[model samples]
Target: MEKERSSLEEMLDAARKQFLEEDLTTLDFKIEELESRLAFSVTTEGGDVCAFCPTYCVA
Candidate 1:
């Protein structure tokens, strides 16, 4: 009764922690990928992304 409920709660808590850790790992990878792309975009042409646009792109 009480003992079983306590064990179940502990198991559920452990599962929740594992799920959050997996999500964090995935988010970390995605952040790294986005950061790399952003850095490349900013550096390739010159300064910012606007620097890459052609003259006609301006108003």
Candidate 2:
């Protein structure tokens, strides 16, 4: 029973790590894509507002 519990915890930890990695990958891709689209305009406040989704919303 102890071995089984340890194995389950390890699996859960692995899954959590994978989820974080995937989320970062997705965020990186979105940032790159938006930067490409905005080009030199990315630095402006208006541009920043237009380039990404709202922060308050969650999945």
Candidate 3:
């Protein structure tokens, strides 16, 4: 059976693809903005999440 990817993994994959596709100042992101965003998934902290949970978010 195929193992499901965690929320962090999903987020990382999306972020990687986005950064790769976007061409902005290369490594030194010319057009970068630091803003608060709600994270539907996060890396393991207390423990790994085997399934999705509600009301859990990060900003």
| Top candidate (lDDT) | 1
**What's the lDDT for all of these models?**
0.75, 0.74, 0.51
| Top-down lDDT ranking | 1, 2, 3
Q: Model 1: residues >4 Å from true position, as ranges?
A: 44-59
Residue by residue across 8-58, what tens digits does model 2's lDDT show?
A: 999999999999999999999999988788675344434234335554223
Q: How would you encode candidate 1's per-residue C-alpha lDDT over 21-58 as one tens digit per residue?
A: 99999999999998987666455444334444543322
Query: What TM-score, to 2 decimals, does candidate 2 have?
Result: 0.63
Residue 19 of candidate 2: its Cα lDDT?
100
Clashing pairs in 1: none
Measured against the true structure, the TM-scores of the candidates, in listed sequence, are 0.73, 0.63, 0.30
Our model 1 lands, by Cα RMSD against the true structure, at 4.4
**Clash count, candidate 2:** 0
Better of 2 and 3 by TM-score: 2
Model 3's TM-score against the true structure: 0.30
RMSD in order of candidates:
4.4, 9.5, 20.0
User: Which numbered prediction scores highest in TM-score against the true structure?
Assistant: 1
Q: What ranges in model 3 sit over 4 Å off?
A: 1-5, 24-59
User: Which model, 1 or 3, shows the larger lDDT?
Assistant: 1
Q: lDDT: which is higher, 2 or 3?
A: 2
